[model samples]
Target: MKRKYSPYTLPPWLRKVRGACAQFIIPICVFQGIRTILFPFTLDVLLLTLLILLAVALHLNVI
Candidate 1:
């Protein structure tokens, strides 16, 4: 059987880093989305997609 995941199991510094990333991720996603919309460059699109995936993973605590 697989063990359950717990944020408390993480080191203090890693938890802090995760907290900071969670706080900042949304705004960064929004900005990347806007930039992707305005520019539509291939690189920008790829970056935005990666950021969105990261945000979803973070939200789901799958990181």
Candidate 2:
């Protein structure tokens, strides 16, 4: 016999909020990368490299 698994499902509201949070975080990082690239004097090169790595990891779903 097969058993149904119900615990994996999330309510609509929770799903919406999670999606919103992801949307918010991704753009901010992207903007930071762009800003860093445009104005390299203000922030350290290592910080910019880390931000770019973060963006790549996000795209690759490593984070």
Among all candidates shown, the one with the greatest TM-score: 1
* lDDT of every model, 2 decimals: 0.93, 0.63
Backbone clashes under 3 angstroms, per model = 0, 0
Error of 1 at 7 (Å): 1.6
Clashing residue pairs, backbone N/CA/C < 3 A, model 2? none
Q: How good is model 1 by TM-score?
A: 0.90
- Per-residue lDDT of 1-63 in model 1, one digit per residue for the tens? 999989889999999999899889999999999999988999999999998998998999987
The stretch of ten residues in a row with the least summed lDDT in candidate 1 is 54-63
TM-score of 2: 0.39
lDDT of 1 at 29: 92
lDDT of 1 at 46: 94
- Please estimate how well model 1 matches the true structure, expressed as its whole-model Cα lDDT: 0.93
- TM-scores vs. true structure, each candidate: 0.90, 0.39
Residue runs of model 2 more than 4 Å from their true location after superposition: 1-43
Kindly list the per-residue Cα lDDT of model 2 for residues 35-57, writing each as its tens digit: 77888765556666666676665
